[model samples]
Target: MMRSIFSAIIFLVLTRVVYAIDPRWGQGCTYIDRTEQIYCFGGEPFSENSQQILVYALNITGNSVLDLSEPQWTDIPGDPNGIRPSAASRFTFTGFPGTDTFYIQGGIVCTSCNYNSGFKYSVSSNQWNQTNKNKPVVDASSALVNDILYSFGGQTSPLTGYDQSNTTYRNTVYYINAKTGADGPSVKPQNETQLPPFTWASSMVYSYVYRSLFIFGGKQLSATEVTASMSDITVVSPQTGVYSKWKNIRSTSGSLPPARWGHSTIIDSSNRTVVMFGGCNDSGKAMNDLWLFNLDDAVWSPQETTGTPPTPRCRHSVVVLGKYMLVLFGGNDGTFNSDINVALDMTTWKWTNAPTNILPSDSSPPIDFPNSSSPQGSEGINEGGDSSSNISGGAIAGIVIGSIVGEDSSSLCLRNETDI
Candidate 1:
């Protein structure tokens, strides 16, 4: 009986000692399979005006294979000679498969101020270089298919005269060569064919198997009023230098999630389905529900998950590691910024919080309130949609910086930016 109790205590201690560290929510993050590493960069941290790049090396299991471990966050230094992007939120990061390069584009630098320029980072070199000189309009939804990056439905706010009432939303679609950062010839909208309504903060994912880019809910704003949420799903296919006319998939069966913006969606290539979670509704309330859309059958179904879920939030990052696990980190739970990390198993639909001791020390100062709009919102637009035009401008000031929250005793070598 004594031996059983002792063994139980040991098991609990081991399980609790390796918790995943938390990052400031609203940053852009993506997993690079080539290095078995996850890179997160740029976002508003609490009370600070600058943002930094952060990296995490996933723990591996037996046989030299890549496996998920509680991620230990590390601060990656900026390149002295490289063009570092200003700290901001609502930017898009797309990883180019088979290469160590990822692209960042179209985020706001301040309330009502947006960046159209794009930059590329080489994981192997740990440096940043300007991509296409032709800036993409900010707040656009993008996806990387084949070697091309496609952007759709963003708004442009002028630097000087930026005002929420004067912002312009677009239905035009643009493409850029992912490898060379040059503009691909634009495809004109099909004649007499209507496109998806002008929207921003929509989520998009590209499925290689189906060769289609799927776009989900976003908000549409007009001079007179605001459409806080949209339910239409638009599909576009890119071929050679052209794109197919947008097709709206109207669900004939199963229930659709409430139309909301700032939710995160990821493609489960193994299961051939898209999973979505957490965003704010038209009422500006944060959500915690999980929803799944089957690409094969074109059906949307809510997923009932087991285990303690992260608090409801929006603007967080979610990435698929390997075939079945989804890693979700950061976001604001309406009132406070959240630094929680949680994962969902696709096969069994179970949620697991990465263990605890590996978490950053609570002694660190409390994070500052996020002062930027949803990377998709205009100067006065809330990160999550709110019907009232009475938006808070106080939270749209200073930039947020990311830092290593805890000590890492592991022997992993810190590579210099030049040596990357």
Candidate 2:
């Protein structure tokens, strides 16, 4: 099955050259429209000094990969601050139905708490504005349940190193209400709530079966040379409707992913399973193996896919693209985050490397959400049918710069610049 999948991918890339993806894109956020279109928003994958939102269209009508365009750009309205926060780490935006706005959560904030500043982009007007939802600005290891966002284990507001052990922010789990209108839930979840024990680098996700937030592996310190392994389970129910209390998501022993951080956890509705991959281990080991938990049977099973899933790597971004294929982007390999793109065909359990885009040294967007200054790519993500690029990194002494994945992430960060 794996061989067949690999062959199919190779054949498609070779024979069907018409669908090839351009390499000049560098990198940006993604908004995939099933088999029709893939809208890539701006970000910094190049020099970190730029910011502008660029949109690329992957038309699947006549072919697969389509034309790239520089449509209307939103300048983030005003001068929010210095170099845009790297979109690195964890990023997932929830769109409220009735409203034309969506909530962008915890991600790289200029290596500082800058990313802690959430903004709302109007899809209809193509405008950007600041949002009030700015608090626990940690990323890379949080989860979602119901509408409320469950933030646990991951890098804290990089300011004072880790926020754990802090009286106000101890081993805590925060639940952000997803209400978009008035007359919502009364007793809301606050940041003051703490947990029995805390962890960073752990993967948090939503479990439909349990109707709560499910958390996976994580470490003790957010940015440490050493890490404490955790088999401990932690779950947080929303304070709103049908929200459950904090319970151990589940605690199982035996060989797991091997104490690591930067791993990605995805909810696979097609297979009714939760998937995890890639994260540096205790001994600075990165993982490339794929594991799945059967939601129906409550089993933690590592998938024995056929083709070579990328070599054991950590910090790679993975998201459910097609029904069975999960799209994985550049991630850390114990050395640095790569710029390669690959797809995992869940049905056949195979790894398919996608086309690579090469960007010109001079051809850069005003806002780069992907690649940035330090030759360090921060992060990027898809939101509201629009792609947002942010660069996040702990480069500055007191700042965690946003390092985006693609080559041009900074272009998206320069929203207010008259020169982006």
The candidate maximizing TM-score is 1
* lDDT for each residue of candidate 2 in 1-420, tens digit (9 for 90 to 100): 563454344334322223333222112233322222223332223334434322233322222321222122112222345223233334434433224344454443333324434544433344455444444444434442333434543444444222333312224444344333111223333322333334555666653334345556666633443454434445444322222233222323345445666566665432135566666777666767676654344445667777546655554444333323333333443344332345565545666554212111123222211111211110111112112222121110000011112111111100010110
Residue 45 CA error for candidate 1 (Å)? Answer: 4.1
Deviating ranges (above 4 Å) for candidate 2: 1-46, 50-102, 111-115, 122-125, 144-147, 153-155, 158-170, 177-194, 221-230, 239-254, 270-272, 295-298, 337-339, 354-420
lDDT minimum window of 10 residues, candidate 2 = 394-403
Q: Model 1 segments beyond 4 Å from truth?
A: 1-23, 45-71, 110-116, 158-166, 191-193, 222-231, 240-255, 270-272, 333-339, 355-420
TM-score of each: 0.68, 0.57
Q: lDDT tens string, model 1, 43-124?
A: 5453343333333334322123232344445455556566765555666567654466777766665443335367887765
Model 1 residue 83 distance off true place after TM-score fit, in angstroms = 1.9
RMSD of each: 15.8, 15.5
Quick one: how many clashes does candidate 2 have? Answer: 83
